[model samples]
Target: MQGSNWPIEPIPNEHDVYFRVHKNYIVNDGPYMFKPRAFVERGDKADQHKSMSTNWEEYSTPEQTQSEAKIPMDNGVVAMSVGGLRSENLTVNHAPIPTIRAHTDVNGLPDDIKDVEVRVKLFKHCRWVINPELSTNP
Candidate 1:
């Protein structure tokens, strides 16, 4: 969800926070984790120095654990993998929730549909933008 022109808004919900991104552009990326410039590894051999001394016998991989943990994601996706099952929790960020473009029908065509206000939350980094629109009034 990067490299596009769109604005993002963050709205607080009763249980969770909602993020919305404008779909005016063909591509976008944002709400991403930002690692400082010094922490970034570069060049083709950047990953060659990673530590590899962990003992496999004493460590339990995520696949062996039955606990459910929230998978960190960019662009407003709440992904999770638990008990060997991979599930995706999609919010308004991943999809282009409809908005009033002056005037449009329920199917997105110009018509007499009522105009409604939308709220959203997002983050930006570099040339990327993350957007997620709220589907309901809050």
Candidate 2:
């Protein structure tokens, strides 16, 4: 047979891929580990958080770049993607957390979501982060 070609692979989604990285905010936090600059601090036990986040350069959703503010009357903002949520890492100081979605519907939720988006806020930037800083010393 003559040389044959194959079609491009379909992008990862809820059906095939186990993880669903957003096209707008795919922040792989792997780089923030051992930068030669002041960004990273070395220690005897530097534990990798193993998150679906990005480095300092890429853009991230608001919740993906920073933790949500905890207060009585504050807007509920969660710092974890749906995937991080299933790992039982949601909420702080009690109460349900909110998710960054564009609409109230959950049809377009990313596969990264372990559970579901409580509130809907279109993820437009990178801000949420969970880089737990552990002390190397006793």
Candidate 3:
């Protein structure tokens, strides 16, 4: 018939498309490993006196960048290769030992923690890390 038309598919909603990524992509862990608490961030404390946080922003210098690249901290200041959302080649019961080193009271640091270096083991996949290094004061 002259009025006949071919069927057409509707365009997908861009917003809806993004939501499916989490369901489609699969992460394989066989040879990969890192610290258990590597991805954790310190919880924000609500100051009773101040209305809002008094945090200030600072740019990293060339020297600081070099130092940060070499060391990884449990406090999550500097960016390290260990704490990625996706780590491939990881096997169960085979967690790699991660070394953490930080300068004394630097990188948005509090007054308490100081210079430290440690090698810690992560048992399987866990939210919390169990290690002797965490017990000692830096």
Candidate 4:
């Protein structure tokens, strides 16, 4: 919300990349769209939207497409969509094939927003932080 203490969304993912990493998975580039400022429409009454989504379409519609889609998501996931890509043809340079998965116990999120409950790409940055940890043998 406008008054929440949440810092801010990193930035909306570019819609044309065709492929980009999120939680270590090289997902379809077109579907990696991101939003910075989202607001749920007044009409939206779905429990899912009230809990996670904040976009107008998310709230104004009946039976959101998200419920029926096979898109993988987090407990509070609010962004990105998996529109089906040919895994055999897509390749990610550093990411392991198959899928890159993560389990979050609110590990790297702002504590204030954690209780508020919003889906985000926090896994995106977690991966970035891992390079240093892995690169240094220590």
TM-score of each: 0.14, 0.15, 0.17, 0.16
lDDT of 1 by residue, 1-138 (tens): 333222333211222211112232214225433322111111233323321011011122222211111332212211111111111111211111122111100112112112121101111112222222333212
Which stretches in model 2 have alpha-carbon errors above 4 Å? 1-50, 58-112, 118-138
Instruction: List, residue by residue over 1-138, the lDDT tens digit for candidate 2.
Output: 112222222221111101122222233346322111111111212323212322111123334323322321222122323333323332211111123211111123243434234222223121223322322211
**Weakest 10 consecutive residues, lDDT, candidate 4?**
96-105
In terms of TM-score, the best-performing candidate is 3
Candidate 4 lDDT over residue span 1-138, tens digit each:
222232322222221011212233322245342322221222224423222222222121212322222442211123222111112121111111122111001112232333333324322321111111133312
lDDT (C-alpha, whole model) for all candidates: 0.20, 0.24, 0.20, 0.22
Model 4, position 15: C-alpha lDDT score: 13
What C-alpha RMSD separates each model from the true structure? 21.3, 18.9, 21.4, 18.6
TM-score winner between 1 and 2, please give it.
2
Q: What is the number of backbone collisions in each predicted candidate, taken in the order shown?
A: 16, 23, 8, 6
lDDT tens per residue, model 3, 38-68: 3221223342221111111122322332333
Q: What TM-score would candidate 2 get against the native? A: 0.15
